[model samples]
Target chain A: MKLFQKMGAALPSAKKLVSGLLDESQPPVEEDQGGFGPPGGVLWTTPLDVLSDRPKAGLPTQSAINAPLPEPAPALPPDSPDRSEALERTGLLCTDIEATSEIGGFIGACLVDSGSGLVLAETGDGRIDMEAAAALNTQIVRAEHEVIEVLDLDDHIEDILITMGKQLHFIRPLEKSPGVFLYVALDKKQANLGMARMQVGRIESTLKM
Target chain B: MSTDIAATTEIAGFIGACLVDSESGLMLASEGGGKIDMEAAAALNTQVVKANLQAIETLGLNDGIEDVLITMGKQLHMIRPLEKAPGVFLYVALDKKQANLGMARMQVKKIEGGLSL
Candidate 1:
């Protein structure tokens, strides 16, 4: 049976009272030949009182009226970390390589560990064996270090530029991290060496450990 | 003395010079002498040239390398791949105190131009 029908069956007197309140045109209680009353002859002063005080016949009587309303869902903390920001921080290295590759006449680019010559990341066509290149460049950097010590010139390496008949190579060791460096190749005819060098400097500034 | 020797002798601070085949990393001809090892320098510089070529190829850029300059505390190293000779390059080292970059570059260009191979 429907809940409302069951409720009506349990509270016949209250149901009649509610109906009377809904229709004012109905005969007054005193004039009506059959006025509504409880089955045991109890009287109700008002319908609201019965609704508030009485429990339904078949429903459980476990302080339903005093049950606390469900608490509103808890809100997120104000200082919660942003997911995108974390991702951007983690992906910063790859983004640096991509930005470098976008320069005009870009051939290949790599981030290498200067001490070990291990390639951390590389972006280039397969034509250039980056592994061999990184290893070889490490030797060149070491040779430069040896020359510096032997000559006692006190100056440091800023960058190395190798211009060829067909290409240009730029190598710059990271200032912040002395053990890592960036290398890039470019086409001679298409790349502006000055602009390319400037772009590399900018990228170096943003590279994180 | 060969042409390579004669050419290198004219430079004021000419420490050493070598013509290296970039593909093989082998020294074709060499002249002069200094603390810098000509054979080792030529081989290492050839790798530099090859690496540059690989980088350009990987970048898919339709261009060429004109020359490369390395400045050190006491010396300057220059590498220039020949235009007529695709796989060969000239590697030259100069004493910074005695070498004039403008003059050295002009002399190297002239020597490269005069070379038969």
Candidate 2:
């Protein structure tokens, strides 16, 4: 239908077409009826209050909601010159992937502790001031965490994205590891989000820390 | 350089979509990154998304954005953070020659409207 309009062709009754589309597109909702009543057919089956708050579906068990995570990560060594090694040396995780194979001359990488809003470890650069990244990222993680709680579902967060003129920023939560995140900064000109996600997925498969 | 995401989605045809989550690096939900292994993608892309999210937040806008676009010689990247959704985002990429970024966001917005959570 949109194509017909583009081809210098006369559209066939745009009003009728749109009205038909609306009927198919608009799902019946309690919020839409006269004064917030249940959908057309819902009232006959269940109480209006019970039908309105229906969850999306397949909710996980309560035990899974607050399931105890594997022990919290170890404290970061304040002065360890080698950040990645320091994180690993804490004897908390078995982060054994060699940086060379994982990143391959990548510009920079870091693990920001989402809880404390601090940089736990960074690789490929000595002067990035990742601490700043941590502090800034903390507020974001906190805000979203609140929203997620409001939604009342505990499926761990996956990732966040920030796009710009010349850079592509990606935030991925270590869902298997809470309050710990993997931050990847990309040259907007160089990285492809599709390809980047694929490569990063491979790297994390073996990257425990 | 079309600003319409719906047209872009129709023309470029990305497999996945990307959204921002009021943050620089949060690649919320993307189209074609594949089920390559959610854990790895989440971990690595997390950094990329975070880096960008912070940069925007630090600018002192004191406000968030609807979406951001990156156009390369060969590709187009799309990011839309649900201003109301907060942490969730939508990420998308399309071929430059084929995409009309102008409509990509529109398509994404339509998708978001139907989103449950």
* Top DockQ prediction, candidate number: 1
Best-fitting candidate, scored by lDDT: 1
Per-chain TM-score of chain A in candidate 1 equals: 0.55
> What CAPRI grade goes to candidate 1?
incorrect
How does model 2 fare in lDDT?
0.48
Give the backbone clash total of model 2: 63
| Segments in model 2 whose C-alpha atoms lie over 4 Å from true places | A1-92, A95-106, A125-128, B1-54, B57-106, B109-117
Location of the lowest summed lDDT over 10 successive residues in candidate 2 chain B: B1-10
User: A1-209 in candidate 2: lDDT tens per residue?
Assistant: 22222221212222232233234354323222122322222111222333333344777445444544323223335664444443344333544323423443245566777878877666645434556766776666665454334423233445555554545545666646766777665555666666776666565554564
Give per-residue CA lDDT, model 1, range A1-209, as digits (tens).
Answer: 23233333444554454344334475323322132543212233223332545455666345543444323223334333432233243343333577877888887888888888888778876555777767767766766665455544466666778665667777888777757878887777899877987898888777765
Indicate the residue-level lDDT of B13 in model 1.
Answer: 88
Q: After superposition, how far is residue A177 of candidate 2 from its true place, in Å?
A: 1.4
